[model samples]
Structure formats: structure tokens, C-alpha cells
Target: MFTLFKRSIVLILLGLLWENASRFSSINPAFCPPFTEVLQAWWELAVSGDLWVEFSASIRRSLAGFSLALLIGIPLGLLIGWYPLVRDLLNPTFEVFRNTARLALLPVFILFLGIGEISKITIVFYACIIPILLNTIAAVKSVDLLLIKSARSMNVSSFKLFLKVIFPASIPSIFTGIRMAGTGCILVLIAAEMVGAREGLGFLITYSQFNFQIAEMYAGILTISALGLIVNQGLILLEQRFSRWKQLPK
Candidate 1:
């Protein structure tokens, strides 16, 4: 908690500046409201349940896409890293897709899949998979050779070796990938939602902007920022849980 507060001090200072600046600046209040006014707007949305409803929609899409990426990326990456044949066959395809801008393909998805939940979720999944897959592959390949040899000297089965030695050693790197992909999931999801959605935090932002509800738009942006922070922090906690072994005395 102390660390979190320490990290937030600068942000709090900035918020205070923003609140005071709007109060005294010559700029139009409609274009740049006080931070407190934005908070009030956020509170109003929350009380009216609009914020919660949109938050629910956004979270659901993000979770679905991110989960799919995790399930597929980890195993596929493991196979690609451990087996040269799989790597040879899949790396080219992965590179081709990864190099393409996800948003650029959004038009194609919408053309075939339409501007529905499926297209938005698909885009998020596609955007998330690359980082997780690439990171998992690197993690597996980077496992300690000494550890592998030590396990081999014990005559451990391949599966047992992977489970007991390789996987645990790769946990840190895997989580790094997860964090990257997790944050990317939100960015891509917001873009997807903004492009075509009736409801979501992204849609709320767009709608508020179109209606010139500046405070509400700012409120939506803040909500998305908070959501991204929560997702990243949650992943960090999970990573720490899996890495408690690192805390053991040398």
C-alpha cells in the first residue's frame, strides 16, 4: 500500500494541478472541466448504473479475448519452442499475422463478421495472442540449461521434467508476456468497441464526445485507465503467488 501511494503521488499532484487550472484558466470550461467536476460526472454515471453497465460490457469482451489468447498462446508457444518442426512451420505464419496492424484488419472482420460482439472479441484475441505467444516461446527457450541437465541426471520423464523444471523456471517470463498481452487486450478491445458497439466504456467515450459531454468523456477515459491498472496489478499479484519459491533462502 505504501508503494502504491508512493507511485501515485505524482499523479495526485497532477490531478490537483488540473483541478485548479480549470478553475482559473481562460480556456472554456466545456472543453476542460475541473477534475472534481469530472469526478462528479463519473459518480453520477456510477449512481445511474451507466458506468457499471458499460464497464461490465467492456470487461466481458476483454476477458473472453484474453482468456482465449492465454489458452492457445502458452501451449502453442511451448510446442514451437520445444520442437523445431512446429517452430519452422508456424513462425512464418505468426510473423505474417503479427506484422499486420490489427486495426487495419478490423475492416475485414467487420465485412465478414459484421459489427457485432464476435468481431470485437476476435480483434482483441488477435491483438493479444502475438505478445503472449512470442514471450512464451522466448521464456521456454531461455530456461536454465543447468536446471535441465540436473533434471536429466535424475532420469526424469520429459513431461515430469517440463512440469517440475522448465515450467516453473519460465513462470517469470511467462508472466511478463501475460502482463504485456493483458494490457494490449484492453487497448485493442477499446478500439474494437469504439469502431462498432452499442455499449462499452469505449462506446461511452465516443458517445459522450459526440454529444459534447466533456466531463462524461473524461470520466470514461479515467474508468478505462483504472480498469487497465487493475488488470495489470492483478496479473502482477498472480505472478508473485507463483514465484514465492524465489523468496526461499539461498
Candidate 2:
């Protein structure tokens, strides 16, 4: 609670500084609109229900992309990490693809998939998959040797050993991947929206800027920041719940 209070104070101070710059300093209001004007613009959008529409649309796309990544990346990563043959065949390709900037493929995806929902969602999926896959592979490969030895000493079957020892140990690293992928989903979704979106916070900001609505543009940006904060907090809570075993003293 005290941490949250300190954060709020910092934000309040920043807001006051921004308001002063826009209203009293030599800064041009055309470029840096007062914070109150941005808030008013946000309120107007909220009252008309436009804000919710864009917010929901972006959230849906982000969640859908992230969900697909998790479903596919985790299993594939497990296979690659578990099997030397699979790793030999796929690791080179994975390294190449993940090293490429996902945004650089945005044009390729748009060219092939067209400027539609499919294109946007596909880009988001592409952005999310690599981190999760890499982290899962690391998690599986880095499992403690002692755990494996103990399980083998008990004459555990291969499948049972994996389920009882490897999977649990790998979970913490897997959650790190999940958190990274979630952030990537939002960022890629926003970028995808900028290219060909009709209904998203990215679209709202672009549209507002095109029409010289500075306040509205700022409101859209603020909304995106707020959404990122909420998503990060949710992921943190999930990590805490699922990775609680890691809290035990080593």
C-alpha cells in the first residue's frame, strides 16, 4: 500500500509539471496540450462508449494471440528441449527467426495476409511465440541434475519422471516466458493496429493525429499506457501464484 502511495505521488508530481509546461511555460499548447485537456478528451470518449469499444478490441486481439502462442510454444519447446534430434533440427531455424525483428516481417505478413484482422492477429502471434519458446526450452534444459538423479534412483519411468520432476522445476522459467510474451503481444498488437486497424487504441491515436486532435491523441496514448500497466500487474499476480514454490529458501 505504501509503495502504491509513493507511485501515485510521483505520477501526481509529473502531471503537475506537465500541466505547468503546457499552460504557463513557453511550450506550445498545440504540441503539448494541458493534462486536463487530455483528461477531458478521455472523459468524452468514455461517456460516448468509444473508449470501451477500442479498449475491448485491442484486449481481445492481444489475448487471442497470446493464448495461441502459449498453447503452441510450450509443447514445441518441450519437445525441442527433451530430444537431441529435435533440437539439432530446429534450433538453428529458431535462432534465425527469433533474432529477426518481428516488425520487419510486418510488411511481409501484410502482403501475404492482407490488411485484415488475420494479419494483425498473426503478427501479434509471431511477436509472442519466440520468447515463450526460448524460455520454455531453457527451463526444460536447465532442470537440476539432482532432481533427475533422485527420480531415476526411485526407478521412475521416463514419462513419470518428466511429470513429477522436470515439469515442476521448469515452471518458473516458463512463467518468465509467459510474462515476456504478454508484453510482446500488446506491443505487436498496437503496431499491427497502426498499420491496418479500424478499431483499437492505436487506430484512435492515429486517427486523432490525422485530424489535428492533439488532446484525443494524448488520451489514446494514456489509455495504452494504462492498459499496459494493468496487463503487467495481472501477469505479476499470476507469476506470484504459480511460482510460489520458488519462494522457498534454497
Model 2 TM-score, all chains together: 0.95
Candidate 1 scores a C-alpha RMSD against the true structure in Å of 1.3
Taken over the whole model, the C-alpha lDDT of each candidate is 0.92, 0.90
Q: Candidate 1 at 167: error in angstroms?
A: 1.1
lDDT of 1: 0.92
Best by lDDT: 1
lDDT of 1 by residue, 1-250 (tens): 9998999999999999999889998867889999999999999999999999999999998999899999999999888987799999999999999899978998999999999889988898998888998888999999989999999999999999988988888889989999999999999888888888999999999999999999999999999999999999999999999999888787
Backbone clashes under 3 angstroms, per model:
0, 0
- lDDT of candidate 1 at residue 235, scale 0 to 100: 99
lDDT score, candidate 1, position 182:
92
Q: How far does residue 70 in candidate 2 sit from its true spot (Å)?
A: 0.4
Best by TM-score: 1
- Candidates in order, TM-scores: namely 0.96, 0.95
Query: What would you estimate as the lDDT of candidate 2?
Result: 0.90
